[model samples]
Target: MSAPGLLRTERARLTALYGSLLLLAGGGLVALVYVLVGQGLYASVSGVVRTVSPAYRLPVPGETVDVGRSPEPARTMAPGETPTPEELKGYAFTQDLSDAVTDATRHRLLMYSLLALAVFAVLSIWLAWWMAGRVLRPVGVITETARRLSGENLHQRISLDAPPGELKELADTFDAMLGRMEHLVSAQRRFAANAAHELRTPLAVQRAAAEIGLAGEPSPQKVARIRERLIGVADSSEHLVESLLLLAVSQEGLEPGSTGPVDLAALAAAELAADPPHALTVVRTLAPLTVTGDRALLGHLVRNLLTNAVRHNRAGGRIVVETSSDGELAVSNTGPVIGPADVPRLLEPFRRRAERQHTAGEGAGLGLSIVAAIARAHGASLAAEANAEPEGGLTVRVRFPLPDGQGAVRGAPGSKIG
Candidate 1:
C-alpha cells in the first residue's frame, strides 16, 4: 500500500487497540460496581427483614388466637374451629406480594447499572480514539514529511518541535540522515561534472587534430607531423585517464586485502630513487615511521606530494622531504609565493592555484586531491600551508596515527632547511 494509506491504517489499528483496552478495563470496573450495588441492596433488605420480623404477630397454622373473653361464655361454635381455605390463600398472597416488590427493585437496579455501563463503554471508546490520535500526531507528521521527500527536495527537514521522547529522537535521527544524504548527492554531482569537463578537453583536442590532418593533400612530412600531434594528444589523454582512475580508487577507499603496516620513510626513499629530482636540490630527513594502511595508496600519496613539489618549483630551487618517528611526513618546496586563500582549494579535485606556475606535462590537477582522499581513507590528518617567505611556496604535511601498542613519539616540529 501507499505510505499514507499504511499510516492511516496504522492509526486505525492503534485506535482499535486503545478502545479494546479501555473496554476491558472499563468493563471490569462496571462489573465490580454492579456487584457492589447488588450486594448492598440485598444486605439492606436482609437487615430490614431481621429488624421487623419480630414486631409483627402472625398466626401460625394449626394455632388459635383469642378474640374475646370466653371463660364462662356460651360457645358460638365448636371450640377448636380451623381457618377457612380462603384465609390461608390470602395469607400466602400477602407473603408473595412482598417478595415480588423486592424482586422488581433488584431488576430495576440491574437494568440501570447495565444502562450506565453501556453509556460509559461508548464514551470510553470515543475518548480512547481521541487520545490515540493525539499521541500519534507526531508520527503522522513524520510519515507525511517522508512521503513528500524526493531528491530535488532533500533540503526539507522534519524539524519536529516535540517534547523529549522516542518520537523526537526518531525525527532527529531522520533529519541527520537526510543531511548526510544531501551532502553525498551534491558531492557526487559535482564530481561527475568536473570529470566530464576534464575528459572532454583531451577528446576534443584529439578530434580537432585528426580532422585537420585529413582535410588536406597527403604528404610524407605532413603525415609525420600529424602522427606526432596525434601521439601527443593520445599521451595526454592516457595521463588524464590514469589520473582519473587513481582518483576513483582513492575515493572508493582501500580494500581489506591491501591493508597492512607500511614504513613511510622507506616508501618515500624508494619513490625518490625511482624518479629522482631534476634541477631541484632534494633533501631527505628520513626516520623509521610505521603506519597501518594500504601500501599502494600510501605510495601514491607520497609520490603525488613529491611530484607537485618538483613540477611547481623554479629552476635551482630546493625540495625538502621529511619523515619523523612520530608518524609525520612533510614535503616543502620553494616555488612562486601562494596566497593563503588558495591553499585549501589546491586540495580539491581539478583545482589549481593561479599563482603557481605549471610546466608542460605536469598533471591533471588531481595530485593533491588524491592525496587528500587517501589520507581520509586511512583516518589520517592532512594539513597544507603556504610558506611565509616572500619567495612563496607550499608545505604539505600528513600525520598518521600510531599503530597498536606503539606509543607516539613526541619531538620538535621539523622545518624546511633545504
Candidate 2:
C-alpha cells in the first residue's frame, strides 16, 4: 500500500469535483425522465387513435379523398385483404386524421424540446458552478501554497494532485519547482558546513601547540599569565573553528547507507576499555544486543553521550549504562544538575550554558549537536537529564532500536573477542 499524497492546496479541486458530479447527475436524471415519459405518451396516444377512433373510407359522392388529389393508399394490407381499386375509387376520406397525427406529433416534439431545455437550464446552473470551481482550483492551490510557504520555499510551485485534465500536469510542475528549491537550499547548507570544517584543522593544531608550550610550569601565577596570553588565542581559535565545523557537518548531514547489524553493547564496552581509564566510577549491564545502523556513526553518537556525561560530572561521580531490547539503550552519569532553562538548548551547537567557564579544553559546544546529527542519521533517539538519584547530577541517554524485530536485549554471547 502506498501513502496518500500530501496536498499543497486541495479545496478548489474538491469543490469543482463536487460541482461537476452534481451537474452530471442532475443532467442525467432529467434526460432519463424525458426518455421515459415521452416514449410512454407516444405509445398511449398511438394505441388510442388506432383502436378507438373510426377512420372514414368513403367519400361524399363526386368527392375524393386527399382533397381533390388522386387518392393513394399510404399503406395497404396483405394482397388478399387489400381493398380493390374499384372499392377505393369514388371513396371520400377525411385527410384531417393524418394531419391531426402530424400536428400532435409536432406539438409533443416541441414540448419535449422545451422540457429538455428547462432541464438543461438547471444543468447550466450546475455547469456554471462547476466551471467556476475549475477556474478557481488553481487559485485555491496557489493560496494554500502561499499559506504554508516561507521565503525559504520561494522556488516551490503549486499544482493539483490527481487533478482532472491539465491539473495533473500542473501539479507535476509544482513538484518540480519545489525539487529545485530543496536542491538549492541543501547545496548552500552543505557549502557552509564544508568550508567551516576545512578551516578547523589548522586552528586545532595551533591551539594544541600553544597549550603544550604553556603547560609544564603552569600555576595560579604562570597559568594566569598563559591564560591571559596564549590561552586566549587557542580558546578563541578553537571556539571559532569548532563552531564552524559543527555547522558544516550538521548541514552535510549523516548518510545512513552504512546501516548493518552491529553489536552496540560490545561497542560501548570496548569504548569504555580504551586508553585513559575513566576517573569516575562506571557501572554497566552489558548486552549483546544488535541493531541496524551506521557503526561509525553510532559509535560517535555513543561517545558524545559519554563525553557530555563525563564533562558535566561532579568529581568522583558514577556513570551508569543501561541496555534493553524494547528498542532502547540509555547511559546516565552524575554531574552538576543542569537547570531546566539550559536543557533545551543543550543539543544545539555553539549553545553553552551562560555560567560555564572551562578554559582547559577546545570544546566549541558542538558535542551535543554532533550527538543530535548522529541520532537523526540512524533513526535513533537520545535524551539528557539530571540523574534522579537523591545526590543527583546530570544524566544523558542515547537509544537505539533493537534488531531481529523487538526481541530482548541479548547478553553474554558466550564467546569473547580477543
Candidate 3:
C-alpha cells in the first residue's frame, strides 16, 4: 500500500511480479488434464466388438447363419451342406482390422493429447508473464515520481489508476503528506511579509516628523529639544532597519567562505586605535585564538559588542575587551551589570526587560538580536551574564565550537567553511 513497498529500483519490482505469475501458471496445466480423461477413453475396442457379435446370429462349423433381421436359413444338417468361406469372409467386416486399428488409435490419441497439453503449458506461462507486467506498471511510475522529488521541487504528485489494489491506496497517502508541507511553506512566507510591513510604517512616520522640525529655526532650548528628539528617532530607525535586514539575510543563509584565521591581539589593537577619544577607556586582554568565519561579518560582530560595552559604561569607567580560544573561540566584554531576568530575553527582537530601561540610546532593541542571529547563522553561541567582579558589570561572551581537527569553523560540514 505504500507505493510498491519500498521498491528501491524498477528491475527488482518487475522480477517480483514475474515470479508471482510463474507460481500461478502451474495451475493452468492441471486444468487441461481433466478434459482428457472424461471422453470414454477407458474401454477396449476388441472386447466391445466380441460382446456385440453374440447378440447377432452365430455361425456353426461349415455352416453360416444370416445375421440380418430376416428368416433363418433351412436346417443345414439334413443335406450336410457346408457354407463357403466366401460367405464367412463377407460376414467379417474389418473385425480383426478394427481391433488392430483401435490399439494404434489409442496410442495416437494419447500422444496428441500430451502434445496439446505441452502447447497449453507454454501458452499459459507466456500469458502469465504478460499479465503480471500489466498489473505492476503503475507501481513503476510511483517509484520514478519519488526519485525526482527534492527541496528544490516540493510540488509534485502521483496519479494512481490500476489493479494491485494496495498500490492505489499508497499513492493517496503520499499526496496527503505533500499537501501539509506546502501549507507550512505558504504560512512562513506570509508571516515574513506582514512583519516587514509593520516595521516600515513607524520608520516612515518618524522620518516625516524629523523633516518637519528641520524646516524652521527656533529658540536655543527648543532647537536643542528638536535636535535631540530627531537624533533619537533617526537612531531608532537605523537600528530597526539594520535588524530587519540582518534577520532576513540570516534566514536565507550566509556563505562562510573567504575567512582566514584572525589574530585576536592585532584585531583588538586595531579597534582601540580606531575608537573616538571618549571618557570610556579601552582595555584589552587578547590571546592567539585561530577562529574563522566570514571576515567582514565576524569583524562586525566584534565591533558591535565593543560599541555596546563602551556606550553603556559610566563616564571614565573602563570597557574591557578580551579574546581567547578553547578548542575554538571566546570573545567577552565587561560593562554595567545586567540583571539575571533580562539576560536571556536581551537577545530577542524588540525585547529589553524593565531593568534595562532608561538606557543612553533610544535603541530599537535589536543590538543583541543581531548578535544572536549572526551567531546562529554561523555555528556559534553568544551568551550574556554578570561580570566576574563583585563591583558588578555585565559580561557578554560568544563561543564557537571547533571544527574537525581544528580546521576553520564554518556553516555546515563540507560546505563553505572559513
Q: Highest TM-score: which candidate?
A: 1
Q: Roughly what TM-score does model 3 have, to 2 decimal places? A: 0.44
Query: What's model 2's overall lDDT?
Result: 0.60
lDDT of 3 by residue, 46-141 (tens): 446545653232356555344444355533332455544644553464365454766677677667766775675677557655665666666677
Error of 2 at 77 (Å): 22
By lDDT: ranked, best first: 1, 2, 3
TM per model? Answer: 0.69, 0.56, 0.44
Model 2 per-residue lDDT at 356? 35
Q: What does candidate 2's lDDT look like per residue over 125-166, in tens digits?
A: 576657766666676775698688775766666646554666
C-alpha lDDT (0 to 100) for residue 309 of candidate 2: 62
RMSD of 2: 11.1
- With candidate 2 superimposed using the best TM-score fit, by how many Å does residue 165's alpha carbon deviate from the native? 22
Give the per-residue Cα lDDT of candidate 3 at 279: 77
Score residue 102 of candidate 2 by CA lDDT: 51
On TM-score, the stronger of 1 and 3 is 1
lDDT of all predictions, in order shown? Answer: 0.77, 0.60, 0.58
